[model samples]
Target: MLLVFFLMVAKSVHRIGPTEVGLVTKRFGRKLPDDNPIAFNREAGHQADLLMPGMRMKWWPIFTVTKFPWVQIQAGEIGVVISQVGRSLPIGAKSARYRTEFGTFTDLRGFISGGGEKGVQRPVLPPGSLVPIHPVGFLVITARHVHGLPVAPEFAALARGGKLVAQSFKLDPKQLEVAVIAPHGTTDVIGLVTTLEGEPLPSGDLASRIGAFDDIVALETDRAVTDAQVIDILMGTKNGLHNNYQDFQAFLDAGGRIGLQHDPLLYGAYLLNPFLVRVELVPMLVVNQGQVAVIKSFVGLPTLDTSGEEFKFGSIVAPGHRGIWQEPLRTGKYAINPRIYAAELVPTFILTLNWANAASQAHDLDARLEPIVGKSREGFIFTIDLQVQIHVPDARAPKVISMVGTMKNLVNEVLQSAVGNHFRNTLQALEAVKFIETREQVQQSAHTAVTRYLAGYEIETKGVYIQDVVFPDELVAVLTRREIANQERATYKEQQAAQTARIEMEKARGTADMQAELAAAQVSVDINGNRAQAREAQAGGDAAYTRITGQAEADRVQAIGLAEAKATEALGVARAAGFAAQREAIGEMPTALVAVAGAVAEGKINVVPDILVTGNGSSLDGLAATLMRKLSPAQDGQPG
Candidate 1:
């Protein structure tokens, strides 16, 4: 019993090891301030000064010493300091203001002299930090351990029950570690920063830019701001000033606002203070080939229209102004803060919009479009499957977006109405057959109309095509029947031609089969023709001979008649003259009697002997005597 008493007395001389901290408490002293749990003037409660690693002698009855492990932060972890004994925190302030002289809150006298308030400290203990924090004045909470003494009744109760954790102060264990915003395999990400401890954001601002767009105002005042200069001004950030919010006091000193930050944390690890800043991982903006990102800034200078007076749809401004930027981000990845800026991707290539059942795989602007349905002039309904190709020039993409708001809106609103209504009205005034036959003309007209319409929105109409035409069922049936009838008629005509050809072929075949007999008959006919020609020549020769003989006889007879007539004429002339002379000589009757006597003397006077009997009577005896004389002559001739 005496040895135990001696050992208890020897406990007055405390020996603190190299890895331990000695927290001193005054057994008898003046009362500490009501607001301060620690005594800086050597007054009551727990003393502010911590005993370092060494032998420290405190009288056993007057002082008490409690050994504690030094505050230790492991790798990939941070220690958040919460002050329990300092000046009361100012109203509306959630954390104590930090000072450079505080020196990580390791110097108790300096921290108290520097006017450190009592609450959570703004600065955090970074990974691998080792310090001897005052046990009663502050509490250090780490990911896996709590390293300071709990002086408050509730904290002491929770700590005794092993329930005093990093979460008890509303700090997430994950947040205590370093923030990583780097590529993981195929996923590239960025950290969007939101500061919890700073001055409130400016009025009418959704986010807080580093310089509050002062640079933007300067650029806007200058009329000769180039795109590269604008881009450089917009890319400037204040992250370097605060060491990525690892130094929260530096962030506050640099005029960081309490809201979403304008700039996002890029590809790196950050030691962000959980009490002051929170980070959300989001996908980095990727503008691919054939595409452009049109930035609409929600945080920048007051909008000043860069688009000319001719543009009335919306304000188009330079890159850093608070409106749709005229210049676009083309084909690259950007770590843009989504909360501060909205990026609308506009394809710079030709975009095909289909007013049909099909949707383009490259874009979804045409997904909601259907075939154009209209009625023809004859009340025939028709469905037209149309496709329109448009291009948004890279330079004009922002203007296009400003006018239409989005590519989908360009399809769904302006182009849809223009194309569909034009076709409907065109079909309403055109006959179905005429429309089908003049599809090319109609497509060309649609191209012209759409070109004219989209030109107003700064969109280039590449082409407009009528992909297919679907006629009404009744019209289709009628056309099919007509086509079938026409085809049948053509088939019948072809069959008739085939039959005529077959008949000709049969005639040729028969002619070929009877070739020898036909040749013999042709030879016989030729022989008969030759014989008939010879007979005709013989008949011609005989006719010629007979004609010559008749001609000669007629010529001879005519010559003889002409000579005899001439001789008779001469004899008559002589007689008439002789008579005339006789008449003159004797009387008219004596002339005639003389002519008769002369005629009798010329005939040998036979007229007187035979005529004497004939003139007297019937002359039967004379006739008998003449007949007897003739008979006697005949008898004489017969006898000779």
Candidate 2:
């Protein structure tokens, strides 16, 4: 009765709360009804009532009830078991035996024993019992201990194969404990064992498990290790190894894989391929900065070719790829023999011949090459007696190198064309002074022709000078003849000028002679007029003198006559007076005689005696003589 009462009281206690659910324990034969009053009841008086939070329940002893604590109300408690043997248990087997406070508990003995009223229980066993349980409820059974049980050897072997051996020896199994076993007992092994068993050991735990290179041991597991977890384990093991050989061995032994790195090696000697082959143009004129070098002119004639060849390393091994090689093998990876291989070949001049031909070839080459020569206009060209030096003051060496090929080809082509077409004519025209006028025109024409020929290039055409135009002997002779002709024409012009001067001088002389003759004639006329005037003056003076003398004589004679007459008259009067005085004595007779005497005296004055004296002449001879003497005396004394 007491037992019945105790059972009923035990059943009256109920579980309640948010996480709790009431569990009912009934007799084996009894069937609880679907509509039973206990299903809805919260009071402890029903067979089993769920006591909810804030709800009241009354304990009743009449019906038996038991409050089963809600196992779902607690947090999960996980347990692990490790085996030293190298094997894993079947899935869920280990979890079944794992004693978690909230999880389902396994009845190991119940599984082993046949069904009965009281199937299996934990208790102190007799000393000789085949299986034993530790006093601690949480103690796990391992394969080693299980092998020691009173089972046949075959049965033990089968048990080891089927159950004790790990499902995966290389990794830990899921939800199962792991065990690391080692032949040698060391702290590393201990740590590794602990770690594999899901007991949190220090990092690098598994790496320390491997004893030596040959050491072999079994680890137990039933599940796969996740990739992330495996990586974490490997990293931890690498850190532990850290350049130590023993640690490395331990890592390998613990199923750790190692990794490494390496470098490439170089091979046999060979030259590097040239990266850039530049063809530039050089101009005959001044080369400007950034100007493309190009061909200018060509000289002489020779079979000339301006083509260039380029070889390249193709496909990293073959040759003769041509053009600029941009890529080369890595220096460290490729060995280059500088002496053995010709990495770059620039054919500056290829043709072979005599000096003249060579020179001609060179000139032709220059025509081809000039196109690629880089030039700076800043530099000056210095020309001496026979040589010329082109000074490039501001030349860009790199640009020059780049342009060399192009310049060469241009120079060659230009020289060839120029010499072939214009050389002979230019030489002929340059032979004489007369042709000097046309020389410039010819040179300009040549330059224009050359420029037009090289128009495809980028060089400028500066002034072209004819250094020395060589003429053949025949051309020289022709030039000399022309010069002679010009000289003769000049001489003839000078002679004509001299003749004109002589003609003018002759005309001037003739005019002077005529003027002198006219002057002489006028002088003669003047002299004649002066002589005539003198003769006329002399005649007039003589005539006037004669007339005066004659008039004086006439007057004197007449006066004497008149004086005689008057004197006779006076004498007559005197005689008459005397006579009168006498006449008074003989008057009348004396008058006649006086008159006659006067007349006679007047006549005698004319060298004749007067007739009146004749009358007295008879007596007059004596008287006359006397009279003459007296008259002479008187005439001498008196003024008459």
RMSD of each: 10.3, 38.3
Expressed as tens digits, the lDDT of each residue in 376-458 for candidate 1 is 99999898899889988999899888888888888898888889999999999999989988989999998899899888887
Distance from true position, residue 457, model 2, in Å? 2.4
Question: Which tens-of-lDDT digit does each residue in 1-640 have in candidate 2?
Answer: 9998776666565444553333332333244343222222333223332333333333443333333222221111112222111112344222112212212222323322322111011111111222222111112222122211212233345466554332222222322222112223321111111111111223322112222112111110213543233222212223234122212223234443321100001211111100100111111122223232212111111112222233221111111112212221111111111111113222222222111211343333332221111111222111111111121111221122234344343344434445344534443434344344575675577667655643333233444445544443555587789889999999999999999988998988887778877688779878888888888888889889888998999999999999999999997687545644654565544544554456567764333334445454575575666445533423343211
Whole-model lDDT for model 1 versus the true structure?
0.83
Worst 10 residues of 2 by lDDT: 270-279
List TM-scores for all candidates, in order. 0.74, 0.20
lDDT agreement with native, every candidate: 0.83, 0.32
lDDT of 1 at 311: 82
Candidate 2: Cα lDDT at 324: 19
Which 10-residue window of candidate 1 scores lowest in summed lDDT? 631-640
Cα deviation of 190, candidate 2, in Å: 71
TM-score of 2: 0.20
